[model samples]
Target: MPTHYEGSKKERIALDSFIKFMRASESVTSKLAHGLADYNLTMSQFGTLEVLYHLGPMCQKAIGEKLLKSGGNITMVVNNLEDRGLVSRKRRESDRRFVSVALTEEGTALIEEVLPHHVELIVEMFGVLSDDEQQRMGEFCKRIGLAAASEEES
Candidate 1:
């Protein structure tokens, strides 16, 4: 549905585009996240594992930042994965307050297994777009995100 804000044409168009963008993002994310259930992971859990898998060991706070997750939520996700022996945490000798999280052997194995299927789903979704259209869309999305970031800083 388009925006019903009885506003100016510019306002309505921008609002309608934003709504469509958000809905598409959510729908794609949900479809991808649905596959995580086969591995008994929540979206956050899978995101955490995927980050650690790709980026190597990182402090808990960095993981939270990378995933855009709250500290408490990241902590719970880490704790849950740790309980499952999928991840392990080590305190920094120089700063006990900082703890790095890393995937265990099991965690590595699991992400390696999950990543291919996750990627395939993304490829399938983007397959609807022609190669050039996909490239343009990627550029547009990145520009939109950067512009939004700048707007927030202002």
Candidate 2:
């Protein structure tokens, strides 16, 4: 079964493009999630580890901001990672109220092992697009994201 929409030409174009964009995002995310499964990681877990790996120690609030996750959600993710001994949280000396999360040695090793293959997978996924096309697509996405963010702010 297919969805059928009756609209003006511009409206139809916008609807079709939005549908395709959503489908593409889902497809890519699903593939990546499957790829992460062998490591016993969810997408959020991997994202949290990756951020800690690259950014060093950060407070939970800052991590949530970087990952665009809610405070409670970030706390849960950090708790899970900490349970696995992949991440550790320490109270800030200057601010005992804040806890900073950092990758453990084990976490660093795990992400280092996984990141290269993940990059390869990403490259392969986008291989169908020429370099220039990829660049143009990135630019277009940035513009759209910025506009959406601005609208949210307004």
TM per candidate: 0.91, 0.95
Single out the weakest 10-residue window by summed lDDT for candidate 2: 1-10
What local distance difference test score does each model get?
0.92, 0.90
Which regions in candidate 2 have their CA more than 4 angstroms from the true location?
A: none
How would you encode candidate 2's per-residue C-alpha lDDT over 1-154 as one tens digit per residue? 1237888888888788888888999999998898899798888889999999998999988889999999999889999999999999998899898888999999999999888878888999888899999999999899989998999988
What clash count goes with each model? 0, 0
- Runs of candidate 1 exceeding 4 Å displacement: 93-97
lDDT of 1: 0.92
Q: How many times do residue backbones clash in model 1? A: 0
Q: List clashing residue pairs in candidate 1.
A: none
